[model samples]
Target: MDESTGLTIHKSEAVALTQNGGLAKAIKPLTKEIHLFDTYVAGVSYLKDKTVLQEIKIKDRLTLQREDNKFDDKAIVVLSSDGKKLGYVPEKDNIIFSRLMDAGKLLVAYIIEIKKRSIDYQQISIGIYLVDF
Candidate 1:
């Protein structure tokens, strides 16, 4: 945990918080963020224009929305800042996050890494954080 900002650091990645300009500078005052989990955005291959994946950058904030009626009841859709549907939170990972959302907790995500394996495949990884205000 950071004594100055009171933010919890998980894994060595939280170290990026300091090197990458800190989340405090990017979010509103009085808001606190707790790092939850990190996972790659699933279903990227389904996107119409794969090039859209290139526009995302590390530290860019993303949004998570609960899809109650989705085939997977625990589905949570990950979206870009502009409201573009990037993909789901991965069926295996959405259960707990969905439960939290169902209980009224706010969750947000940020781009942590973008990996390009080939001309047609790019993987976007994000860190999910629970917000308290």
Candidate 2:
């Protein structure tokens, strides 16, 4: 009401603009990444030892450490959970992976499956998962 002018104003009930509800639910967590880079493990002299690949179990976590001090700067050695040397990442993929590791990104590798019958990749197969904070 406007007392000075003796005028009055009326308003209708407020209506919500939303049809169903508020904002949609937060986006689902991203599925873990699984990238298989070419592995140099095939022709490496060390895999020659039948026992080196022994004791490796499926779903076993692996650690990738940069071998900058070694002759191959891009060399990323794969280590078992028990600190055993599994092998080196392929040269083509090692550079990218090395940079990612040096950048302090968290990546986890696990023995996805063991190919006992397959002619290729017969030792074991691995999957790398990205760890998001």
Error of 2 at 62 (Å): 0.8
Q: What is candidate 1's lDDT per residue for 1-133, written digit by digit as tens?
A: 8999999977675566656667666456769899999998988888875655767788989999998654798999998888788888999999999999999999999999888877777788999999997
Tens-digit lDDT track of model 2 for 1-133:
9899898966532223223442222222443455645243323345545454667778788887777645678777777787777777767666777778889976667777766644333555666655654
Q: For candidate 1, which ten residues in a row score worst on lDDT?
A: 12-21
Decoy 1 TM-score against native: 0.74
Clashing pairs in 1: none
What lDDT is obtained when candidate 1 is compared to the true structure? Answer: 0.86
- CA lDDT, every prediction? 0.86, 0.63
- C-alpha RMSD in Å of predicted model 1 compared with the true structure: 12.9
Best by lDDT: 1
- TM-score for each predicted model, relative to the true structure: 0.74, 0.58
